[model samples]
Target: MSLWVDKYRPRSLDQLSFHPSITQNLKALASTGDFPHLLVYGPTGSGKKTRIYATLHELFGPSVEKLKIDVKTFTTSSNRKLEFNVLSSPYHLEITPSDMGNNDRVVIQDLLKDVASTEQVDFTNGAGNGSGGHGGPTRHRFKVVIINEADSLSRDAQAALRRTMEKYSSNIRLIMISNTTSNIIPPIKSRTLLVRIPAPSSAEVASVLAHISKKESVKFTDSNTEPFFEAVANNCECNLRKSLLCFETIAMQTAQINVSNDSTSIIKLDWEVIIENLAKSIAGNRTVANLAKARVVFYELLSHCIPPRVILKKLLFCLISEVKPSMATELVSIAATFDERLSLGQKSIFHLEGFTAKVMVALEK
Candidate 1:
């Protein structure tokens, strides 16, 4: 079965739940037939992409949803070749050039030129008739290029984008989606209209959860359901996508359990539980043997695709609750050090293990 997040996602601007003001503004803009380049950004799971797709559907109709994936190869100025997979429809193209890392500039410039150079086919007139009194020429005025995770784009690539945005303004509209606009250069920011989508509030998230449960015929009347969803929403940190997934996971796990007892255990993601346990183990024990064991758990989390930074942050929070006030200050300092180091180097495991070792040493002294 399809995930509830996708299954219940709003297909149009009017269907959006939170940020009604933003949706209304978008609806008004969509009706105008012509609008400036858009920069839609927000925290994860906050519906930036959903709104982008909805806007596209509003602008180009259902044809925009008939997308196909294409893998294209481009050669960099340094003589290196890079291949990127892009999702494209008749009206627009979507790509995450950040996947190419520093070479993203090459991909951005080449791809933009390739798409903008080609004039849109005018099919407004009846086919085979060059000119007609009844049917003239209808043409797509412009195409959209949506770049996702744009904040991950290197500074150099973003600079290249600024020029391309100006050069292709007539034929292409660029919609950049990112977690924040801070990383976006001023020139590009000046060129596009910015739209920020905030994460849903706890009540809004709970309401959406309720709607999903009712639609799926899940038993919401169970005593465990209310607190369970509230806990999920809070634990998800206002991330609607994570909240929904957590809800589904817990529902499946406790499908057969008695409702009264189920409320006693607030469901946490398996990785979260693992991180919590790891934190307790480190705080409680300070020895080489325990450190070694902790490393194993860290690797296990990494294997599950839990980012090293996320693991470190969760570990820090868990440690804060378990340690003394003075120890908490020391631990935060150590975490910040490692976090900075982690960003400067590619050896995430080394930094992660080093942080654990430091914590152990601190506790021992």
Candidate 2:
């Protein structure tokens, strides 16, 4: 069975329920034969990718949905083989250069060059030439190259991309998705049309949850189901993806006879629960034993592929509520120090454990 996130996802600009103003603007951009490169920035679960796809649908129709995965390999200067999967259709291609590590510059430059060298063709019905030959009446003059996690791209890759963006403006349009734009350099930022999609409000999230709940036949044991949805919306911190997953988990759990509709029964993501427990432990006590336990948990979370920065951020969020109001500022400053370290330094475990130890000390005061 498909996940609810995918099953109920808005397929086109018109289908998007929230952010009507942004939807209207995107539709305006898509109405034309050409538009500038788009730098789409938003928080997680804020529907950045969904909006990008919807815009693509407006430009190329359902043909963009017929995607195939292609794995391309590039040989580095050290003769190392780097391979990553590319999602592509006749009209567009998507890639995450962050996956290529330090070699991202090579991938970005070479890949964009190759894609831009060829002119785009429209094979959809009357959009293409009658002979089905190279000479075709193009529905759109450019192919889209979607760069996911554009903020995580290396400086070298971004530098190379700035030049390539101008050179290939004719044959390609870039749609870059990122959580924030602080990491993106000014040159590339200047070249693209920036679109910011904020997280939906609690009411928006609750409304969506209510619709999905009705469609899925989720039954609330209590007479007043409003609180259930509102509680869920708040608990998820306005993240639509987490709200859906949490709601689905509760629905499944409540199906087994005699389930309570209280907020305490809400099922949080496993990693979140782990971090919450760790925060409580640190807040209550500061000892070698507690620190040792935290180190083990840190390794466990890292092994499970949870990013160190996310671990630190969630830890702070949980820790802030446990400590006195005066401590929140100090805690945030400490987290900021380690957050930069996590970005610059190689060993994330050191920063993660360091931040926890620091928090434990502050709580001890």
Candidate 3:
């Protein structure tokens, strides 16, 4: 069975919820034959990608949904071959150049040029010239290229992107998706229209959870279901994707445990539980030995595929709640320092360990 998030995902702009005005604006943009390059920025699980796909569907119909994954190899100026996987359809392609790390500039310039060089056929005439062709009135003039995690792209890659955007405007429309726009260069930002999607509110997330629950026929006692979902939403920190997964997990566990008998049993995600434990450990005793133990926990979290930045943020939140009011500001400052270092430096483990050690020292004072 498919996950509820994918199964219930809105197929078109009209089906989207939680931001009616944004959906309407996207529909309007899609209806037109010509639109500028778009920069969609938002927090995680804020529906930026959902809206992008919906707009593509509106532009090219259901054919956009027939996607296939391909591993493409590109050679840099130094003749280094870099291979990465991309998702593509007949009308558009999706790539995450950040996956290429420092060599992202090579992928950006080469991939964009390769895709943009092919000019599309004109179907404005509604009929081919004395031949059977795939032309019938409605057709787009250009293809779309979606680049995810654009904020993580290096400076050289962003510069390469700016040139590509200008050089290929006639044959391709670029859509850049990132968590923030501050990292995007001014030239690229100036050329593209920005669309900001905020995280959904708790009520909106709960409503989506309710819809999924009703559709899946998950039995929840009427008295406890609403508050349980609310707790899930709040715990997920307004991330719709995380909230949905949490709900599904709880639903499955509720079924296994006999929902009627264990109405108050709250199911916590394994990662959250681990982070909470680490928080308690850090708050309990500020010692050199405890700092070493925290290092082991940091590696444990890393083993589970949690990003270092996320781990740091969650630990900060937990510490804030457990410590005295005076320590909250100092902890936040420390987190911000390490967060910047984490972004600029290549060694994530060092920064993560450093942050934990610093937190312990701050607590002692």
Candidate 4:
């Protein structure tokens, strides 16, 4: 409860961990209900969900205690349809994936249909008499549907969801969170009150870390300080979630490497060091980077147990940025598709690199 990050999470709209203007827009939504169908567009692990949660918690606390908020939190790939009716308490409900599924278009469709139907959940009490909610007998008529990774939704799914959203506007408010809003349908965009949750500024991030250090009762040394910040900023390209994860990972490494709670000696790990290890293990960077150390490095990377898609993403990024400009765009577009295929579990992890020849060419530059 006292973790610095959580403790310091902007409790009020004014206190959000970002620009005052940004939080003000969010605060207005929380207090006034003008958030339309919100598209919280930004990278993952950013504060998109936090702000939403804060909004919900603040907006409906006493009422939420009285009226259940049935939340269905699933990715684009689940076999079951979520329901909200028979709950004992009229509180918030969340549906999260038990297992991750592939990024195939079909998976996207299933996600759309299930989520589009959120407006129709029967909040009726299980009693055949029709009065189970509110500790009396009737359920209220307010609902919010949140979709994570809206950018990953397929075009067709997006179209379907748009229609459903339009049809159900009176009963539902849709919020779609994503790394980028460009992938969302324009029709959906037109209806929703778009809110920008910008990445945390470096100063904000440091403040977060420094605050966390005190909360965790850890000591910080000067030498590894910059690296700690670097790791957080790098993981998601400044996504707070990933940064926190990287931060925690560094802390764990420190604890393990030193066998002491001495946070002062914690050595921050570089993103490249992580990339290098993973590449070595999977034999990914064989043709470039380090021929002499390929096998061992690949082995080391594999030993670290980096996920295939992460490896693929890294490989893709390396190619796009490090390679020649001639076909970088084409390579990136194809890689995005490949990443989808990998997520849909439609393709093997090893074959993802097949989409990388263009990238490989770029790396050669």
Candidates in order have lDDT scores of: 0.81, 0.85, 0.83, 0.54
Write the residue-wise lDDT of candidate 3 on 1-365 in tens digits.
Answer: 99888989998887888899888888778766557899999999988999999888777778799999999998878888989998999889999998887889888988889989888775555232211223344346688999998988888999999998888899999999999998898999999999999999888988888788879988755545666666677877888998888777777765632434443334566887888888998899778888788888888889988978789988899889889998888999999999878767777889988998898878777
Angstrom error of the Cα, residue 337, model 3: value is 2.2
Number of clashing pairs per prediction, in order:
1, 0, 0, 22
Best TM-score among the predictions, by candidate number: 2
User: Best by lDDT, which number?
Assistant: 2
- Arranged by lDDT with the best first, the candidates are 2, 3, 1, 4
The per-prediction CA RMSD against the true structure, in angstroms, equals 4.9, 3.6, 3.9, 8.0
lDDT of 2: 0.85
State the lDDT of candidate 1 residue by residue for 58-89, as single tens digits. Answer: 76667788899999999988788778999999
Over 4 Å off in model 1, which ranges? 125-139, 220-228, 254-265, 281-299, 326-345, 350-365
lDDT tens string, model 4, 55-163?
6655544333343434433343355443322111333333222122323234334544454455533444322211111212222233566666676666666676777
lDDT of 3 at 135: 33
Instruction: Name the 10 consecutive residues with the lowest summed lDDT in model 2.
Output: 128-137
